[model samples]
Target: MSKYESVYIARQDFSTAQVEALNEKLNETLVGLGATVAKTEYWGLRSLTYRVKKNRKGHYTLFQIDADKDAIAEYERQMRFNEDVLRQMTVKVDAFEEEQSAILRNRDERGSRGPRRSGPRQ
Candidate 1:
């Protein structure tokens, strides 16, 4: 079995519960294929740099999977056939990071900075 990191964006129109259901489904699918899902993260709905499938925002999710190539291929195939999934990408990784993804970390940093000041050039 090889390690892989997969990130997927669900259509913004779906409710949080619906998104979670999709996540659960993905987990079940992978496990059924004899894979171990090490970690899963829901990054929440976020703005996209560009519109995708008429959506300007999407619910982001990540998965750290240890599985065979056939299992990974099956997972990708399922994602592609699912209409709620706006976009998905899977990449082979040497190891999975223990910390939150950069997007979530950036969100935390922005929140800690407090409100932005108006009229710069102080």
Candidate 2:
């Protein structure tokens, strides 16, 4: 089996619980196809650089998978056909990283900064 990182943005209108249910369904489908999901992360709803399907923000989720090409293809196909999925991407990786993804890590790091000050420099 090869390693892959799959990320998707669910429609912003969906509740967190609904997004989580979608993740569970996808995981079950992958497992049924003989794939193993090593990690799952919900990055919560985040703003997009540009509008997608009329959505300004979306619920981000990531899955680290160890599976064959066929399984990956099937998973992508399913996601493509799902109405709630705003966008999805899958990348083949040499290996999975055990640590949290950069997005999540950066969120923590950014939390320490005080609120931004907006004014002309004195």
lDDT of each: 0.95, 0.96
- RMSD for all candidates, in order, please: 1.8, 2.0
**Segments in model 1 whose C-alpha atoms lie over 4 Å from true places:** 116-122
40 Cα displacement, candidate 1 (Å): 0.7
Q: For candidate 1, write residues 26-50 as lDDT tens digits.
A: 9999999999999999999999999
- Candidate 2 residues 1-122, lDDT tens each? 99999999999999998998999999999999999999999999999999999999999999999999999999999999999999999999998898999999999899989899999979
How many clashes in each candidate?
Answer: 0, 0
- Identify the leading candidate in terms of lDDT: 2
